[model samples]
Target: MKQFISALMDAHLPAPDGLQDGMAHTAGRRFDVYRNNVVHSLITALKVGFPTVTRLLGPENMNRVAGAFLRAHPPTDPRMMYYGAAFPAFLESHKQLDQMGYLADVARLELAIRQAYHAGDAPAMPSEHLAEIPPEALLQTKVHLAPAVQVIRSDWPVLDIWNDAQTAQSKAQDVLITRPAFDPIPQALPPGGATWILALMQGAKLGDALDAATTEAPQFDMGGPLTLLLLGGALVSLE
Candidate 1:
């Protein structure tokens, strides 16, 4: 019976022949209505989850894209919040949107923001803790990042695009997201900042992370990035 109901929900079962009783037993109209509701709810959830993506694609285009996405990837989990994890990759393969090269990255940035919102919270260590550590041990110390810290890097100007769409003022361009406090909200980091955050997120020591950022960008300023991380609560502690 459960299997039959599942099949019916997926529109896999055909109506059985039974005259007037057919409509009563199948309830085809009701089932269709229910299916439509489910689809609509999922689509609405995706819109909320990826507002920037929707803005870039426009309402009508986003509706079509959302419908196609639903057909291609049906929801597996009962949770609506996590439904659009594959959306970024889906955008990448969509032939119609192939010319919009930055769309996938923009979706990625939005997803990262959602993830950061749900990540576990952690307390940030005071600046004096780093000063207390011996100079020689700094390179060997394992650094920790707050749960709200999310590091995203893309060739496209995803950070700038997100800011432009979300804010009313002008700002620098880069692809990085950091949520300092529950009320402060997330924002983009400057160039090389994301790389530095990535290194620390990977459990690299302070010296190694700084070195990696320097290697990636010759003029990368370690002090500036460190300050940004500290202020954003990205650096939780050192172990």
Candidate 2:
């Protein structure tokens, strides 16, 4: 069964030897149709999973890329939504897509959004919880972010490139993804924002994360990213 299924997925492979339709010798036309349908379904799933990649490559080019990706990385999980986790890395290594270095980052953003959408739900910590902390205690506090929160740091203006698609306005940008309500939203992060959020995500104390952010970005400010995270309900708890 595995060998037959594998052959079905690979166009180069001939229909499994002795494969037949209703005991008749393998029907080339029927086999071709079945193969095409399976390929088409996989491509369609890729298109839906990576809409930004599809928009960037267009339908025809995306189909080609999807076909190659499908062959190289077949779905291992039953859930089709989780199938394209490696596509961003695939794009990075693809020779044909060398010109679009930013495409991989864009795909990563989309993948993060999809993962956020499907993430397990958890109750958000009250925004006032931060206000309740004393200034001295705040430094020692370790924050917990919601499971759906994701930060993507890119050398290229990934969020801008994603939003505009045609013209990228900046050279570099960081993105913060959060699912505050029913849908997930990806917002462009201000300078030092991703650094700070990522540090916090790793279970660093506030003081440590702040120091890391300041070191990473000399002009780092805690206000903006803090507000964004609070408003997005991304803070789940603090220890």
Give the number of the best model, judged by lDDT. 2
List pairs with backbone clashes in candidate 2: none
Residues 1-239, model 1: lDDT tens digits? 55534543466564333313354564555555656676688789889989989998998899889878977787899887788999999999999998888889888888888888777888888988878888898777878888777766677667768766655333334554567776335565666677777888888877788788878777887777677767777777788
For model 2, residues 98-186, the per-residue Cα lDDT tens digits are 99999999999999999999988878898888999999899899998899999998999999878875677678989999899869899
State the C-alpha lDDT per candidate: 0.75, 0.89
TM-score of candidate 1 relative to the true fold? 0.83
Clashes of 1: 0
Overall local distance difference test of candidate 2: 0.89
Task: Provide the TM-score for each candidate, comma-separated.
Answer: 0.83, 0.94
> How well does candidate 1 score on lDDT at residue 207?
78
For each candidate, C-alpha RMSD in Å?
3.7, 1.7
After superposition of all CA atoms, the RMSD between model 2 and the true structure is: 1.7
